[model samples]
Target chain A: MSSLGSKWKPVIVMVINDRKLRFGQIAARIHVISRKVLTDQLREMVEDGLLIREEFKELPPRVEYTLTEKGLALLPILNLLEDWERNYETKEVLAEA
Target chain B: MSSLGSKWKPVIVMVINDRKLRFGQIAARIHVISRKVLTDQLREMVEDGLLIREEFKELPPRVEYTLTEKGLALLPILNLLEDWERNYETKEVLAEA
Candidate 1:
């Protein structure tokens, strides 16, 4: 539960789904999260066994993140959550009108 | 996301599920949460439209809490999360052995 407790973790997982993404790429995708918070969240996710942080030995040094099997398992559940929020928001809008 | 951000919110939602429960009944069901925290969580759930708080004009003035449509909708999602955790724990145990 702690793994999913962070608001950004699920978003990050969704962003990095099947593709491996660099830190900058991930930060760029999620506009609301700050770099520091993103770093922290990524670290936590790696520690929780949800993500794999791989570093490439290059001139500038590149790092990429990919989801582990555990993290991949959350996709369907998160999709459901997104659907629930969408429906909830639609209902709220209708109620307001 | 804020609605489900609290650690106790999901637990409370699961605790109340389909049946209406009094404050004491809810507290008794979840031993770890303090009365103050439970009260706060329930109030937030009601405010978030996840719960309905009804007061009975009985001799003792009983009050009960029940899940709203939105709350009831979370059951399947929460169940999936529980299943994920169970599998995750099992894997952890296997890895440790």
Candidate 2:
């Protein structure tokens, strides 16, 4: 539960699923999160064994994140949550209408 | 996911699932949470349409909370999350040992 405790972690996992992305790319995708918070969350995810951080030796140094097996296991649960949220939002809109 | 954005909300939902429990009872069950935080989270749950708060004209003005249809709908998802978490914890413990 600690791994998914942060609101942004699930979103991050979804964003990075099946693909590798650099910090700036992830930040660009989730524009609402501040850089500091995103950095903290990503580090926590790595510590929690949900993400792997790989650094490549290059001129400016390249780092990317990918989901570990544990993180991949969470995809279905997050998908279920996302589906539930979508339906709930639709109902809310209809009710308001 | 705003409804469940707070970690305490899920735990509260689990504690009060299928049963009408008063504020004090809920507080007693999840003793780690302070009364003020519990009150705030309960009110947010009510606003999110995940709980029904009932006021009873009793000696101390009792207030009890029960899950709404939406909240009940979340139970299965939470159950799945709980299962995943349990397995994860078990693996972590085994790895450490």
Candidate 3:
């Protein structure tokens, strides 16, 4: 969990969770992130066993990124976080009135 | 979740999740962490609204840290991560044989 401390790591994971994407597609989807930083984050995620990187031999030598089983497993936790904010946090604030 | 990326943040949260603890107690539980870094992490957690810090007036000037509702809300996610490692990640490895 501590391994996910970077600001963009979760966002990057969320973007790539359902579909395998090329590096350029990921960068464009998360355009606020710098190319170098996005590259670093992807590399780290791969090292952490949360992502898989595949290279296809073609005229362009395409590379794609996909979430591994370990990575897909994180989606439940992310959904719980969003639900916490939506249900618990917001409800508490409204109650404080 | 990304905010919890530090090596010590998750450990610290686990220590404080069950009961409120003084600074010394928390520091002692996660003893491998340096004092300065522990202090910094605790401060950041407070600022992030994940922790509530209370200071008592006394000759000894005591302070205690507790997880707020927001912080407590993170437990499910953390538990899911643990379950994922124990169940999914390990199962996949065992199956790939």
Candidate 4:
């Protein structure tokens, strides 16, 4: 789990799990994340073979991220986790806390 | 995934996912973990409703840990992750680095 241990790594995977996303789009979707941390997470995933960082030449320049096969493969597990969190692990745990 | 974000948390879960385990069993399986960090992670999981810590009034007093329903529900996801890491994410990524 070390590869995916950070708080933001799986969230980043969640955001771009299905489609390509620009940096701003990702940051917008997960608003609580700081830009530096997001950048660092993305870089790590790219290094780890879980994500593909793409760049396009344009007027202002464009960058996007998408999952590699390795990354896409993680979707089902993340989906299960989301389901578990939503249905079984959420409000009750918080209320208890 | 805040409930499961710690590096040792999922490993701890994996260690005892299918059966009850004593502290020494868990620590032995995940050999690199320090005793203090393992205790802290187990305590956090118990607090978060993912594990049950039990004490037995035996000769020396024995403590064991098991997963709650919430934690058991995570088994399939963890299995998939273990599969992914074993087949796809391990050697190739490490060799590339």
Q: If you assessed candidate 4 against the hidden native complex, which CAPRI class would it receive?
A: medium
Candidate 1 chain A: worst-modelled 10 consecutive residues by lDDT:
A1-10
Comparison by lDDT, 1 against 2, better one: 1
Q: Which tens-of-lDDT digit does each residue in B1-97 have in candidate 4? A: 8898887887888789779999999989989989999999999999888999999999988999999988998888888888988878566967779
lDDT of 1 by residue, A4-90 (tens): 886788789899998999999999999989999999999999999999999999989999999999999998898899899889989
Candidate 3 lDDT, tens digit per residue, A1-97?
4546676777888889779999999999989899999999999999778899999999889999999877887877777766765675566578778
Question: Candidate 1, clashing residue pairs?
Answer: none
lDDT agreement of model 4 with the native: 0.88
Instruction: Using TM-score, give the best candidate's number.
Output: 2
TM-score of chain B, candidates 1 onward in order? 0.95, 0.96, 0.81, 0.86
- How does model 2 score on DockQ? 0.66
For model 1, the superposed segments whose C-alpha errors exceed 4 Å read B57-61
Question: Could you give me the TM-score of model 4 versus the true structure?
Answer: 0.88
lDDT of every predicted structure (CA atoms): 0.91, 0.90, 0.81, 0.88
Top DockQ prediction, candidate number: 4
Q: DockQ: which is higher, 3 or 4? A: 4
Q: RMSD, each candidate, Å? A: 1.5, 1.0, 3.0, 2.8
Task: Give the lDDT ranking, best first.
Answer: 1, 2, 4, 3
Cα distance off (Å), candidate 3, residue B95: 8.3
lDDT by residue (tens digit), candidate 2, A37-84? 999999999999899999999989999999988889889998998888
